[model samples]
Target: MMQPDTLTVFYDGGCPLCRREIATYRALKPQGVRWINVADARPAAGGGTGSACPLDRAALLARFHVQRPDGRMVSGARAFILLWHRVPRFRWLGRVAGTPPLPALLEGGYRLFLRLRPWIVRRAVRDKRAAPPG
Candidate 1:
């Protein structure tokens, strides 16, 4: 069971970009945070320290999601802000981004990025495949 103050992060492990970014965060060893890979068939079933996700697997996989210690679900840019605040070196960025206007602007950018993500991932995969092995 998770502590009352623990935060849960749900992410799409199937996406290469998501995997790489989550790996970076995991490397940081952020405190009081739990990472869940929604891409797995049984992600919410005995996968972490908490109960099953309140949202369905598809919904969880579709966007960034974070479960606050208060049991509130936050998504998109706001979710990112919450996550950043918990990360050691990213607290300042989170605070700034959470400031008025910035959150709205960031959400807009995130939406655009989501729309372009499929194309971006395809191109990245192609490029990686074309690159010569070292």
Candidate 2:
């Protein structure tokens, strides 16, 4: 509800699942928003708040992050909702995500997602390990 300039989304690019979801988001959405794949979310000088991409990759991979036009940063479900709202079709999903119960639901879902993420990461790592040296 604050300013509407640029939006920065912090996601773990190493995770194929996360990348897939981001790809879907990018596919449907236009150029209105800027997606930032950060390795970390910790505040940095002109980082996060700034409209930069591929910054602080280490922090972003740790968790989900979103920086609003108000220069405020939110993580987890809140961040997801912010990006969802930007999509024309998913506006309602974003609104629902903001609701008290929905945020809770989203948190629960995120927990489950986390449970599965490690398996995904391990498998991905294993695949890379198995690949012949090139």
Writing each residue's lDDT as its tens digit, candidate 1 over 49-91 gives 2345678777787799999998899999999999998888888
lDDT of each: 0.87, 0.73
Candidate 1 similarity to native, TM-score = 0.91
Q: TM-score of predicted model 2?
A: 0.70
Candidate 2 local lDDT, residue 5:
80
Instruction: Judge candidate 2 at residue 93 and give its lDDT.
Output: 92
Clashing pairs in 2: 38-60, 39-56, 39-57, 39-58, 39-59, 39-60, 39-61, 40-58, 40-59, 40-60
Clashing pairs in 1: none
Model 2 spans > 4 angstroms off: 1-4, 39-58, 123-134
- lDDT, candidate 1, residue 4? 83
